[model samples]
Target: MDASLEIRPAAAADAEAVAALLTDFNGEPVDGPTAARRLAALQGIETVLLALRDGAAVGLCSLRVVPFLSADHPYAEVTELYVAPEHRRQGIARRLMREAEALARAQGAPSVYLLTGFQNETAQAFYRSIGYGDYALAMRRRLI
Candidate 1:
C-alpha cells in the first residue's frame, strides 16, 4: 500500500478526495462544497496536499506561509493534518509534513508551526519527533 501511495499538491478537482479524508479523520461530515471553495482559494498562496493510494485519498495536510516572529524568519503553519484510520502509522503524515517543510524552505520559510489540542498526545509526540516545540501562549475572548 505504501508503495502505491502518491502524495502531491491538491487541485480543485481533488475536492471530494480531500473532503472525504477530512471527514474520516474527524469522524464527522465535512461539507464538500466548503472544501471545494477553500481548495479554490488555495490556488496560489497556500498549499493543500493529498495522499492517494489506489486512486483513493488516504491522507491530507494543509499548509500556509505567514510572517514569523522576526522580519527575517517567515514560516509556514500546518493548519491541518489527517490520515485515514486504515493508513495510520505508515509514515504518511510524516511524508506530508516533510513535503510541506521542503516547500516552505524553498519559499524562504525558516520553520513550521502547528497547533494540537490538549488531548492529542500522539500528535504532540509526532510534532516533537519532527523537531517542533511548544512556543505560543494562546489566549481567547468569548464572542458570545
Candidate 2:
C-alpha cells in the first residue's frame, strides 16, 4: 500500500478523474462535463469514492445506500469498482471496499450488494474472495 494513497468521497470537481477511472473500467468513454453535472445532480442520491495516489486519481468505487418502500432495512449496493490496470493487486481495491463498507455501516445499512457481469470472472472471484457471494438473480428490461 502506498502511504500517499487517499480514498475519499467524490466531489463535483473530482468528476473528471472519477469519470476517467469509470471509463477505463468499462472501456467506454465518459464525458467530463456531463459526468460533473451528474455528480452534482446526484449529490445526496449516490456516493462515489475516489482513490488517489500521489495526487493522481487511480481508481474509483460507487455505491448507493437505498431506502426501501416496504419492510426491510436500508441496504447498500456497490455499483462500480475499478482499479487502474497498473494499480491492481496493491490492496487499493480492498481499502476502497473497507471505506465503502464503513460508510454503509454508518448510514445504517445492514447489508451490501453488488452484481458483476456474468463473464467478468475475475471480478466475481475478487468479490468472492472478499466474502461476497451470489444472493439473488437480477433481471432488467429496457422500458424504452
Candidate 3:
C-alpha cells in the first residue's frame, strides 16, 4: 500500500466518490442519488471500506455480516472488492481484505468468505495467493 493511502469506513459525505468507484466496478455510469441510496440501505449489516489516495476514493470493499442458523456464530462475506485500474498492484486490494476481515472479527463473525467468478482468473489467482481455497459451489436463481 502507498504510504499516503488511507483506509476508512464510507460516510454519507463520501457517497459521490464511492458511487463513482462502484460505477467503475460495475462498468456502468451510476448516478449520485442512486449510489447514495444504495449506500444508505447498507447502513447496518454491511460495511463499505474505502481506500483513499490524496483525498480521492480509489478503491472499495463491501463486507456483509449475516446470521447463520447452521453455525454457532454469524459469518461475513465479501460482496464487492475493486480497486481503480490505475491503483492496481500497489496492495490496496489486499489491505482492503485485511481490514474487512478485522472488521468482521470485531463484529463477532468467526470467518469471512468471498466468491470470485470462475472466469476471473486474475481474481482467482489473487485469492489463492492470499490463502483462500475452494469451499463450495455458489448457486443462485434469478427471481426477476
Candidate 4:
C-alpha cells in the first residue's frame, strides 16, 4: 500500500466517484441518482470499502452479509471489487478485500465468498493467489 493511500468506508458524498468506479466494473454508465439509491439501499447489511489516494477514490469493494440456514453465523458475499485502470497492480484490491473481510469478521460472519466471470482469468488468478479457492459452481437465472 502506498503511504498516501487510505482505505475507508464509503459515504454519501462518495456517490459520484463510487458510481464512476461501478460503471467501470459494469462496462456501462451509472447516473449519480441511481448510484446514490443503490448505495443507500446497501446501507445496513452491506458495506462499500473505498481506497483513496490523495483524497480521491481509486478503488472499492462491496460486501454483503447474509444469513445461512446451515450455518451458526451469517456469511458474507463480496458483490463487487474494482480499481481504476491507472491504479492496477498496486495492491489496492487486496487491501480492499482485507478490509471487507475484516468488516465481515466484525459482523460475526464465518466466511466470505465472491464470484467473477469465467473469462476473467486475471481475476481468478488474483483471488487464488490470495488463498481463495473454488468450492462450488455458481449458477444464475435472469428473470427479466
In terms of lDDT, model 4 sits at 0.91
Candidates' lDDT values, in order?
A: 0.85, 0.87, 0.91, 0.91
User: In model 4, how large is the Cα lDDT of residue 26?
Assistant: 88
The CA lDDT at 4 in model 3 is: 88
Name the better of 2 and 4 by TM-score: 4
Local distance difference test, candidate 2 = 0.87
Worst lDDT window (10 residues) for model 1?
66-75
Clashes of 1: 0
Error of 4 at 90 (Å): 0.6
lDDT of 3 by residue, 51-123 (tens): 9989889999999998888887888999999999999999999999999999999988987899989799999
Location of the lowest summed lDDT over 10 successive residues in candidate 2: 66-75
lDDT of 4 by residue, 35-103 (tens): 889889998888999999999999999999978798889889999999999999999999999999899
Q: List model 2 lDDT by residue over 1-144, tens digit each.
A: 579999999988897897788788878888888789878877776799989999999888887887888637787889889999999999899998998999998988888899888998999999999889999988999999
Cα TM-score per model: 0.88, 0.94, 0.95, 0.96
* Full ranking by TM-score: 4, 3, 2, 1
